[model samples]
Target: MLRQDLAAIVRAGFSAAAAGRLLERALAPGDALPDGALRVIAAGKASSSMAEAARGLLGSRIRGGLVVSPEPRSVPSPFEAIAGGHPMPTTGSEQAGRRALALAASLQADETLVVLLSGGASALMAVPAAGVALDDKRATTDRLLRAGADIHALNTVRKHLSAIKGGWLAASAPCACRAFAISDVVGDDLSVIASGPTVADSSTFSEAADVLRRFGEEAAYPGAVVARLAKGARGDVPETPKPGDPRLVRAASAVIGGRRDAMDGAAREAGTLGYHVVWIDDPVVGEARIAALLHLRGVVARADGVARPTCIVSSGETTVRVIGDGKGGRNQEFALALAAPLASLGGAAAAASAGTDGIDGPTDAAGAVVDQTTVERARAAGLSPDTFLDHNNAYAFYNNAYAFFAALGDLILTGPTDTNVGDLQIILLA
Candidate 1:
């Protein structure tokens, strides 16, 4: 029953129909460029699907462009494959970044640029700012991830340090541009997803400097990098295309997919299963353990006096502050923390959690599902959830208990889901 419920939640969010509809809304037929007017250039996890949808809408009128994503074994017409890194920047990311830049620069003055963007675009479409080497950007990105910085903060620093981010791509285009964004950030900050290749950024260099001071590597930034940011802050380097920038007057953007969509899907499925569903807002942030506690509190509040089964559905990215020398991702840490808490609550209700993408952190498992039995089981094995969490080993804790859940048990793994809209978490109170 527990597995069935969790599976239903996963299926609800990832359907061919919903994905297609989102693509249609993101690239409405009328929004397509006029005959021989559009040049498509895109990158991200969902770029493939988004590109396919664009080609479908535009047909022979579409001008071909490059797309960077995890390798799609099955080729779709009109989408070229350029595999790149995710969650971590790599050398391949650098190559794709350059290609994206060259493509954007190639747009004719009379043409329209249609860019397909989503999460992972930052790394998959990396183009370092003037003085920063690709390696430097990679180092900084890795540091930010390890530091547990949220997407917005991490992207702020990334935009300042990259030539392609912070609306630089749009500004560089020789023609009007429109970006179709699948927002993974909580608030759908256009500038954060892939560092806002098509949208303007409001964060200043000083702000980026402050983020570095707070959680970034100030000394690690290349000397030239530091000077460029300082210059940009002083209005010399050109602020990322702003609202009224002539270039953006004809440019537009829309978020076609996000945590909200994921939650809505889960809620509908849960409702059909005779479970009361409660969906929190999409942008929930903060430390993973604390977030887990908050989620548990909500469930407790509803379950205390209710007789009908309840399922708490949430979709958002959370941060995990890595302190110990352990291995796990934010989702794993969240599940481990929640497991102990739910067990302590001592109810008949079971719990399940997962990353919709089927992979969390460095581990292969998406996340975990626990019930009152998890804590007691772990304790009997002389393994404390708290101890594993302290060591940043949530994967270890949950895997040993036979509770970790990944899509199709990771055998049918889609690797990186090409598109990221944070995470989908469904906590069953039945």
Candidate 2:
């Protein structure tokens, strides 16, 4: 019963149709565009759905556009769709970047460019700056991700090394540009979402360099990236646009969907299921393992004196420092880390952590669900949860742990949710 409630909550929180409705309301008829030809350029997981919402409102006004996504989807419009890489940029990502730039540049003073931005745009629309190779940029991103750098820190450096990010795309166009974003960042800082392709970036090269050094990743970053950042920090290169930059005069950005929306949705679903909803006010961040422990403690605290079933929900993106060369994303690692504590609850509780985007780490599973019985079941199946946690192999552990989780329908799998609002964690106490 708890598993079913969790699944319902996840589904309600990540419904593409619901996301579209929110977008449509936010972009009431003719609000996003003016009386001119519209060229839409959408990027990230929610690109296609967001674009479709625009199409529903502004039919033939969308002359031509492009949508860059991590997977293929049928776009019922004239926009060209391209599959780009995510988590890391690839050659296709470079090509998509060029295409988006070209589309932005093609806009005349009388036309409007509508950019739909989302979580993975930094990678899906990758254009390395001059003298910086794509491989170098890719390597830098990979290293920072493995180092457990947050999105803000990762994009701070990326904004300095890219051609399209940090308001460059907006500066390149001659006409007015408006960006609609579905934020996946903790604070919903427009400049950090998808690296702020159309918004002014307040981060500087010196700060980017500081982030690398602070994270102990400077030595491991690609040589070209390091040199470029150093040169920029020394003021040898121009900085990204700051607040009130003239180049961003005609560009406006607003977030249409975010973590709060997902949280509300989950809360409503839990309430409908007759569970007392306990909203966790703190945003989930920092190390995955630590976040898991903190969340577990919160659940235990909320479980006290509860006469009815209760659901606790929190939302935010967490980081995973790759200590072991294991295969799991932050969500999976978080779930794995909770095994011991959940076991201590003795079947009275269950929790799930998963990326709303339908992918976790590099694995196919979205995330895992664990209860008090999980550790015992694993032990009975000759598996050790501690060993997997040490190896950071949550995906493998969940997949091979006697199929108990699978048989219970605990593994949350929703393919490429077509939207992202960071990660959602749900804990049910009975």
Candidate 3:
């Protein structure tokens, strides 16, 4: 019963519908565009939902626009939605990027541009900078990701190498521009969300270069990618717009939802279920497995004076360094890391970690659930959690190889919440 309840609570907080409702309210008409029509561009995993919200509020006032999404679909008659690559950019992504830039450039001085952004947009709307090949950019992106670069660091490199990121999109338009976002990063920094296409960037090419160097990936990146950063850092190429740039004076941005919303939603649902809630606000970061160990220690310590039926909630994004050839995301790795430790503790508890977007890595399942008996079950089923974990094969541990989690009905499979606010974890103790 607690396992089912745990999944339900996580769902209540990470609901795409709830996130969509927030977007609809944020898109409410503030004022009419005097003397001109309005144009819009929505990007990221939440692209279609955001575009739909804007259409409901603005109607014919919107002239036409593009929605760069991770999936293909039809929005309204005037708006076109194209499936772009995620975690990597594809030809469709390039088309979206160019179309987005052209759309922004078409805005007249009296007209306005409304940019809707969310997670995955950085890759979906990627337009390589001058002389930078899309293939090279893709290779660099893959390298940084596998090297475990955080969102801030990853976006820093992306901003400098992109034609439409790091305030470049906003700078290209002379008309007044406003951006609304659903953040999937820590602190909800507007400039980091979707690499801040419509928000001014303070990060520099130098920082981007440093990120590559820090990860020991500088030399391995494509020569053009390397040369572009070198040129941008050396001022041979123009840098992305910085803070207080005149070109960005016409643009404004806001973050409407993020990890905090996921946490708050979980807390509310846990309370309604008659559990005393304990929230750990410190963000979970760093290596996925290590973060899980740290999180487990914190939860166990909190159980000291707490009442029974306690729900411990926290949400943050983490990175997974792909050392082993395996299939799983950070959240899956995170959940797998907890199995042995919690089994050793032997308590009446159930823990679940999942992405709000209903995806973890390349897997169809959002995440997985683990209980004290998880390790025991696996051992009896001729499986080893540590072996699966060491190979970064958490998905196999949960689904494919033995399908232990599937057998227990603990694998979380909520398809495409279409909202990105990082990941949520719930530990219910009774």
TM-score, per-candidate, Cα-based: 0.91, 0.96, 0.96
| Model 3 segments more than 4 A misplaced | 28-36, 401-404
Query: Which pairs, if any, clash in model 3?
Result: none
Model 2 lowest lDDT segment of ten: 13-22
Candidate 1 local distance difference test against the native: 0.72
Give Cα-based local distance difference scores for all models.
0.72, 0.85, 0.86
Error of 2 at 98 (Å): 0.8
- Residue 262 miss distance in model 2 (angstroms): 1.3
Best model per lDDT? 3
lDDT per residue, candidate 2, 99-165, as tens digits? Answer: 9999999889999999988879899999999899999989888888887889999999999999999
Point out where model 1 deviates above 4 Å.
16-19, 28-35, 72-74, 220-224, 234-236, 302-307, 400-414
Clashes of 2: 0
What TM-score would you give candidate 2 relative to the actual structure? 0.96
Residue-wise C-alpha lDDT for candidate 3, range 246-360, written one tens digit per residue: 9999888888788888888888989999999999898888889999999989877976689888899988998888888897588889998998887787568889999998999
Over 1-430, each residue of candidate 1 has an lDDT whose tens digit, in order, gives 7657777776686442244467787557574444456777768777777777777877765666787875543435554667778777777887888887788888888887888887778878787777678877777777777888788888888888887888888878877787878877888777787788888788878887777668855786566666777787787876666666776666777777877787888889888889877666635568888888887787567556655577777778788878898885787777667776766765555555556556677777666666667677678767787888898888777555453333214112335554567777777765
Provide the clashing-pair count of each candidate structure: 3, 0, 0
Cα distance off (Å), candidate 2, residue 157: 0.7
Q: Candidate 2: lDDT of 34?
A: 70
